[model samples]
Target: MSTLTRARRKLRAHPVAADAALAAGVLACMVAGSFAEPHGPEGIDWGVRTPDVLSLVLMTLAAAALAFRRRAPRTVLAVASGASVVESVTGDPRAPVAMCAVIALYTVAATTDRPTTWRIGLLTTTVLTGASMAAGPLPWYAQENLAIFAWTGIGATAGDAVRSRRAFVQAIRERAERAERTREEEARRRVAEERLRIARDLHDVVAHHIALVNVQAGVAAHVMDKRPDQAKEALAHVREASRSALGELRATVGLLRQSGDPEAPTEPAPGLDRLDELAGTFRSAGLPVEVARGDEGAGLPAAVDLAAYRIVQEALTNVRKHAGADARAEVSVVRVGPRIEITVLDDGAGQDQDHAPGGGHGLLGMRERVTALGGTLTTGPRYGGGFRVHAILPVTTRTSGARDGRP
Candidate 1:
């Protein structure tokens, strides 16, 4: 940086030193100006003409008071004004002793509010001008009295302008900082939402297929010795379930890969269009799931379709895991007015094992999905002897794309 720029930064960093330097500069200027002759051989001469000892003393005291202007601006202004009044009355040769008072008034104006600046500025101008006119050796129309009025007014105006510019710059800086913080908070919120979405997708994919695999594996083991042929078919079903699970898992994990990696699977997300396939897998596991639809061929939004399919899938998985071996599940999809309703009922023998560990999380995830689309889901044990899951989803949901399905 330039030398001037570095010096300015240093002065700003050390305010007390900056103030002391200002006081010394002002004192030097006042002392030099004090010797200029008020009237000499030439018209308005500028030659040195020393004032009385008292005038010199008052000028020194006024300049010294400016050193602490920022610490006590009002007090410094008062001291400087008092010294100028004394010099105006006593000095035979008036020596610009009021210059220090002008500097003091500027300091007070910059530090105080505008109302206070006006009050002090007017008071200083009136008292100094009145004293110089009434009691000094010069007449009322003397140029020195006019100079005091002009200088004090300039000081107040310049100082007030400086204060306004500083306040404006500070406000701009605070606004920029607030905007940066808001952007950071918004970014964090979006990342958290994405993480939750990935987690829900993983759970739905794993839980549905894993439950079927568990069932088929059990069946294969039970009939392995007595009926080898039946055992072979059950093992085949287990293999198919596992393969489907792996495919879905790969698709889900593919979403996490970097953009430069291999392309993600082109297969579409599972929706109500895959209802038959989902039901067939459960039937293969010997759950005897029956599906009935009355959606009237109405197109559903992408989010609603996906959410409806996952809800049914998770409900059926719960049935297979908790319901007794003789359980029979019935799934229904219906359209009523502007809403699509889904219900899954099971005629399983009621058992305490229905409420399994981590079971609440599955229901909670389902509820989150439905609620996001402004829908509702209700799942609980039926009055007689089984579990029931009922969901009401809006047919005309606000989605980013149109999904081909009758939810």
Candidate 2:
């Protein structure tokens, strides 16, 4: 930082020292004013001789001490006030001794709490004004004595005002800074959530399609020469897998774009209505797929349907990968009054079902998708002997306004 800025910062950090310097300057001016010839007021020319060197020296010392008034406010006030009283009672009362005392009072008021300032300030003003009037052989209402009273009051009032304004400004700045931090933190949290949802979706989509490709490639390799036609069909399955992978990959990646970007894709997401096409893909793979429908199809929102389809698809893919070839899986969809229920079951001995329910990514992704849309999912071994994936999705979607449009 520049030298000027550094200096200002240092002074602000030590406001007491700054106030003391100001008080010292004002005291110096008052001392100079005291040197002016005292015009005999009201023709009372009985001034024997002006205050000698001794009284002047005392006034100067007291004024000089005012420079540290804010640093040690009580000490400065006590010392300056005592010096003023001594000047009034012992030395010449005409000297400018009260100047340092007035400055010290103001500093005390500004640095300390207001109640303390008021009590101390009022006592100091009364003492200075009363001593000046009574010790000078003048009436209590003399102009000089009243001027001390007014100056003391002004000093206390002005100091309090300065302190209050500084406090108010500091409070406003703190509140604004806190609000800015909250906004930044909230934005970061939203970004992190979006990234997680996108990652989950990618995991589910890729795992399903990639697993299928792996299966087809293995079959094709095993039958390349003896079953040339079967190899061609396996290659076709590979093509289908690659295409589906591309489409789902696009859907997952599309979430990365800014919501308002012109390049962003505008497309309808998969929903429950598309479950038929999904089932057909499984049927083509020789898995006997059965589907059930409900009359209130229009009630299901797009997001709910998509989550439902993903749940069923993920479950079926796991069955194909893990279940024995003879296993016949039953996939059922039912709609109750307020919910759509999905269940995937296999008659095979599903001791492995203990682990199938662990989505690692697929089941996890399914749960996140379902809950994001205010739904619930459960997966475990069915009673008597098979693996089961069941999910309950609400007809009314949860609009959480999160990134990736999870809701």
Best by TM-score: 1
Q: Candidate 1, which segments miss by more than 4 Å at Cα?
A: 38-44, 129-141, 350-355, 399-407
Tens-place lDDT digits, model 1, residues 312-389:
999998888888889999999999998999999998875533367646767878988989888998888888898989
Q: Residue-wise lDDT of candidate 2 within 230-268, one digit each (tens)?
A: 998988988898898898787667767686755644566
Global CA lDDT of candidate 1, please? 0.86
**TM-scores of the models, in the given order?**
0.90, 0.83
Task: Note the residue pairs that clash in candidate 1.
Answer: 35-49
The Cα local distance difference test for each model comes to 0.86, 0.75
Backbone clash count, each prediction separately: 1, 1
- Per-residue error (Å), model 1, residue 325: 1.9
Q: Which residues of candidate 2, in runs, are more than 4 Å off? A: 1-24, 37-50, 133-136, 258-262, 348-359, 398-407
